[model samples]
Target: MACLVIHGGAGTIPRASLTPEGHQAARDGLRDALRAGWAVLGQGGLALDAVQAAVVALENHPSFNAGHGAVLNAAGEHELDAAIMDGRDRRAGAVASARYIRNPVLAARRVMEASDCVLVSATGADEFAREQGLDMVEQSYFTTPLRQQHWQRAHEEKAGLLKRERTEAEKHGTVGAVALDDLGNLAAATSTGGYTYKRVGRVGDAPVIGAGTYAANDVVAVSCTGLGELFIRRGTAQDIAARILYRGDDLSSAAAAAIADLTADGAGAGLIAVDAAGAMAMPHNTEGMYRGSVTADGVLSVGIYSDDFAAVETIG
Candidate 1:
């Protein structure tokens, strides 16, 4: 009953803003991510490895905001954040404000496995990644033309050169994955290029262990994407696990309750979770979230809009 779930991001993605080509691109990206993780789980890999693989695929995909297509900060620079947790013993690692690491998630995994620290930040994190021999890239590697335009528009709006406000879609984005492996071990990973035009050094919940990522064997593994501040204040990921642990809530109920609380506060976000039994849940308060899932038998499902979910034939 091993299973994996992933989310590209969650927000009020206006249908009119999305062209058909863009919609297909996002779905294809989700499918690639699912297959990347499924390949590991299907071959008896660790849950941690599976999740990291999945998120790496997302980070490489240009459609999402994690690695290559990360948005610029107020300083017009990229400051990426990522985290990974293993439910086997709750060991975790995170990196914040990383400027040069190509895959922040891989750096996070190194922090968890090779270093004594659970979190590293700024230049120190970049240096640590270098020392660990992880792939490194110039800051420009993260910038895309679209992101540059978005940044420019943000500045223009702030300077009153543009009258229209940026849509909710431009505000935030993240990539995350959670999995229950054949061994019953669970794991979660999240990565993001914080919100567009965020202040320099503004770290989001994507790298915060309990807020955006959490995993506990025999319980639940969770990864969240949305308004970082709200997720941080709510301890969103841990809250779901707590609900299931203390209140006897099921995976779906607990995850729904957590999102419901956020919705009540007018937050636009979502999350993906998986239990030790291989049960999976994806719930969001926004109009749409790029999400997908795969089972041990190789069946795949992907969705964007609320009613757009489709299950495909077993993946090879």
Candidate 2:
């Protein structure tokens, strides 16, 4: 079995303060998560389980943005969104505008397994999670003093500055994992805390399967993170797969072209993809994106910045 995994970019990365040890720690975490999924697929686990295991490992990491270190909403609470898709059956499930669910990806999978629906909102998704006996914490459990302080600082910085870019350098809010397993199965999953100081119900591409994540056995599995508006407008994830399947582009070319197109249209985002042949690509238009992947040969590669600049390369 061959496996590949990528992240949008690790969040809260202190560029100036990052020690060599800190950088290695982040790389090791990503490598370990990829290995977790690779081990599952090596043992003949389903692609869906592989993706879930990798994402669960990331979600549990307080250093990342998906679960523990998630951003705060305008209400000063942490609302989450997530989705998962199984390409074998084209079955997908998603939750948007949710709060208190620990692993939103699992909730999305439950929705796919248990319902005839494709999308579920916060309250309804919470109901389904409750019915399934998943852990449910109170809203307060979602907040951290650090995140709250950051939200407060963002609000203070943005006060009365309407024309300023809405994003802070340190506040990327999404994380994801995608995989192509040995059985020729493909799966993708994405989760997010949304933008810092986002509105109570603001839903980004994270929970929308085709927008934030998509997979198909015929092509590849894709997961995206970054500016949501551009993803929704361009349908980035599905478009990448479409170009590969319909237009005959390879995985690397399709991913690079898709991200380049998004960047040309003024969207700052990044993507990770893996094809049936185990080819992988992770690209971003931003100054940096925390991404890494493991090839079929057990060689792990991790990178933080664009390849065009030699000074920014941190790991491989």
Candidate 3:
């Protein structure tokens, strides 16, 4: 069986806060990403390649917070981070605080296939991607008026000129994918632009191997989105796999347990996981999570609100 799951992010997404256009855009983006990965899997591609392809689609969509529409830091600059992993060998590669790379996930894949190191950061990561001839873009390429407004509001809030709550988009967001290929291999990938108005060089769970992304043959593949610091401290991604392997919990139960822990601490979080048996679990502690999935039967679904999950259609 082959399955693919992906998440745009998780946070306090009040239904009243989203416009009709915004909602439609999100669903469209999720569908595109799901199809992108499913296409690879349908053709019998590697799980690693499927996950990478899905994440690359999300990274390219402006509606999500990975590549093109990444959030800007307090310094008003775009800093990206991404990670990719192969479950069979536990091989992983990551880059953090990269400024110019067009798709950090692609760079992470390059690092995994081409380098001896598991992680790279900042200027070095940027330069390395350039040396590899990956697509490079100007910093301005990532900036969008929507993100600029979010940063402006946060900046005002920080200056004590305004008192307000952060919407889901401003609170935080990430894009990720996890998949099981026809060959029974599992893989996971994650990418993010961090939170609104964060410090310029801050690195989140997205670029961390075990924190935000993890995969293992016959076990599970996991990719997470949430408050990065909380996800890191809890080791959330790997925790689900441990609960299943060490504690004898089923995939759904293990995912629920990990989400319960984060919920207890008021950390809005969510994750998508697929076990080797083709079972899938998407558990979240937030009001809503932008997520989608494709089952082994090729039934594709997309959801945002907590109650919105129903098969939207079947994908070939």
Best-fitting candidate, scored by lDDT: 1
- Candidate 3's C-alpha runs over 4 A off are none
Residue-level lDDT tens digits of model 1 in 1-316: 7899999998535787898888888889999999999999998899999999999999998788899988899999999999999999999999999999999999999999999999999999999999999999999899988788889988898898987778656777899999998889999999999899999999999999999999999999999988899999999999999999888999999999999988888888899999988888999888889899998788999999888888965885
Total clashing pairs for each candidate: 0, 1, 0
**Residue ranges of candidate 1 with Cα displaced over 4 Å:** none
Ranking by lDDT: 1, 3, 2
Compute each candidate's TM-score over C-alphas. Answer: 0.97, 0.90, 0.98
| Candidate 3: tens digits of C-alpha lDDT, residues 1-316 | 9999999998635788888988999899999999999999999999999999999999998888889999999999999999999999989999999999999999999889999988999999999999999999999888888889889988988988876667766757999999999999999999999998888799999889889999999899999998888889999889988998899899999999888988888888899999999999989877889999999889999999899987999988
How close to the true structure is residue 60 of candidate 1, measured as C-alpha lDDT? 95
Q: Who is ahead in lDDT, 2 or 3?
A: 3
Candidate no. 1 TM-score:
0.97
